[model samples]
Target: MTRVNHQHSKGPHEMPATGGDRPRTDHGHSHHAPPRSVEDHLRAVTELLGRSPWFGREPVRLPLEQAAGRVLAEDVEAGLDLPPFTNSQMDGYAVRSADTAVPSGLQNQHEQVDATAGNPGAADSTESLTSLRVGPTVPAGHAPDPIEAGQAVPVMTGATLPPGADCVVPVEDARPSGFHAQGATVSVPAGQAPGRFVRPAGDDVVRGTRVLRAGDRLTPLALGTCAALGLGDVLVRPPLRVGILTTGDEVVQPGTPRGPAQIFDSNATILRGVLADAGAEVVAVHHVPDDDDVLRALLAPEAAEAPHPDLWISSGGISEGAFEVVRRVLSGPDVAEFSEFLHVAMQPGGPQGLARVDGVPFVCFPGNPISTWVSWEMFLRPALTAVTGAPSTRTEVRVRSGDEFECLPGRARVVRAHWDGEVLTKVGGYGSHLLAAAVGVNALVILPPGRGTVPSGQDVVVRLLT
Candidate 1:
């Protein structure tokens, strides 16, 4: 495990410790808890995710065509050797190498040794076996009869090698080219070695060898490999089912009319796309208001009859407001366990929470659009990736800042920025609600905590989002 170093202490986002059951207050709105470091929060989230019911579920078989992008759940062994038999690697004549020997094919007699495995010393007593007559041509797909000791069989590329012929001499190398009827003598050149131009059986993959292992995400190449091994179907893990809920009294659906104080809901839409890209199946997406009773009833088991999601994700209503519906309704011991609701040492995504409602995992994000997006990228993406063996969500690059960069002294700053393959420059202001500018950028510049200023051209760590 890679150890993450995180500084945990009282920072700007923390409120005075709220003793007992009292809610911590910040600017008159009740707060959840004190702050934790980003690393600590990620560790907590990862630990909780490790306990999920689907972690070790049995694999399900799916057709090879439908298995792409799904994680392989079982190791696949090849049933038969690749190519399945010895075959010609070129358009050539299958011939015994001794017949083409440089010393007129009589070396075996002098050595008194056998070269052929099953037939011993047959060449020792025979006449110089060169310039043999051509036998029947062996085209692809039609198996040829066994070749006599001194004869050459014409074979095409990918044609199976005939028994008693240990090597192939290309048609170009044989005198009087092109395959002809029996008794037409074709001279084979010497120095043509055995096993040359022959694709030996199991050269690519041997039977009983495990070619594909569990936890591998099936790419097109991986699927093709399984098909090459003669697999009609493969065992794969199921995509995670997630239920997304976006809440706030002032938030409305995008297509609906909005009042003066209301804004179009972007959290649900953004998260749905992010989760889908991460190989999660978004089973449900809903908008919830600040009314606790209405929200509770909608989440109750009776209301959720079908399509139970494996996980639940919510944005807004997790911060320090009295009208925090998710906090107010589900904070009790009876409903669910709200494990940690606190600020992390990170700007734009400081507020976060985790819960378990009716045995289903729930993750809560702050209301700000950019903050919600950053939280998903930093926390949920990595944890889920570890489970699914999906490719890494972020691409890290060391870059120099194009200009002077500013950061909050006590909190790590994740600034939306544009990276031009060389230098990174911050885009828009450092406000969490600046979604318009956020969309224009392609990466995030992660500034560590307690470092307020970065001089121009200073090296920094960058995480590519696109």
Candidate 2:
């Protein structure tokens, strides 16, 4: 078990000391301490996750099929040339360039013979066309017999070029405009280049060339590239193992009967889906009622079973409310070695907490469904990408706002929006409990702290969601 030493001094983000080693539990909200900036809280989360043992664990080997959505741990080099041999790039006839070149006497004569001159003799002339006897047909994936100097072999696309053939003339350029039987004559255009319609060996990728580098995510196209390189497996970083806990007596499992004051739990489902998309494996999920002993027992070292999680994430019970089970249990002196619960200067996800419980990192998010999601996107997602490089980072683009909106003073407004390639329109209200309203949101518009109305057509930064 690795222990992280965090300075417990009263810094800018810390509240006044409560006269003990353990930091005071504000339940993620305290009127005394100023709310930490979004950037500062994000930096803290990044550092916490970056220093853990799970971040430095050895890479694992997985088959190519199973490597999708995983980060590559090492560079992958091509073992052989992509084409491996000279092949025809089109379904055509392969012939030596010299055989297609016009004779010097004929060239000089045809140079002055213009069919556009309206001369019957020039229009009917065949002196510029080169005729060659067609050899054996070369289908794709078949080796071809050598062709003589004046012979043209009918070759399909991707068929290996027959020996002695230096170029291919596409069937569309031939006089017949179609393939001919062996031993039949075909008329081809004169002056064909040596490498026309031919794919040379190593054209796409050369042997020993680095095709994929370390820290690259194995997406669908990436996996296809590995398959094209004849690789059966690849080395990738193991996913971060995570445990989830949702607290609050008012929260009940979905599909079960609920009391008058209870609401169906959506935090657990949301966290599971989001964590899976971010490439983290959820090892366990538990719902802890607003009871300190129940929450404490579940997080105890003895209570943890095999396949222990590298980190724990809990939603609800961290706010300033009276029944904040997570804040009460985790911030206790005997429960956590280091813990801090504070508010961030961001709307919808202001309350947050981070701690080290039994040498494992634990991150606490607010109870609201949108707050939990926004916290993951605003802080945890970026931190994971920075530390591990799996689950590629989101793209932020500055675009014109599609609608006019007001901003709050001293707090960043994270509003869900839809990006239409040109402008960003707000999707749902800014309330954290409007989870159902965020259905079609694909972008997050981040408006910095200010007390004024933003007119339409003003530029705003947006983070695109995958």
Largest lDDT belongs to which candidate? 2
Give per-residue CA lDDT, model 2, range 337-442, as digits (tens): 7778888999979889998887788888988888899999999989889988867889998899989877989999899999989878898787787787798999
Error of 1 at 380 (Å): 0.7
**RMSD, one per candidate, in order:** 9.9, 7.5
Q: What TM-score does prediction 1 earn?
A: 0.73
Tens digit per residue, CA lDDT, model 1, 308-341? 7777888987766555666656665555754556
- Which residue pairs clash in candidate 1? none
- The regions of model 2 sitting more than 4 angstroms off are 1-31, 103-105, 108-128
Displacement of the residue 307 alpha carbon in candidate 2, Å:
0.4
The number of clashing residue pairs in model 1 is 0
What lDDT does the true structure give each of the candidates? 0.76, 0.83
Assess candidate 1 and give its lDDT: 0.76
Judged by whole-model lDDT over C-alpha atoms, candidate 2 comes out at 0.83
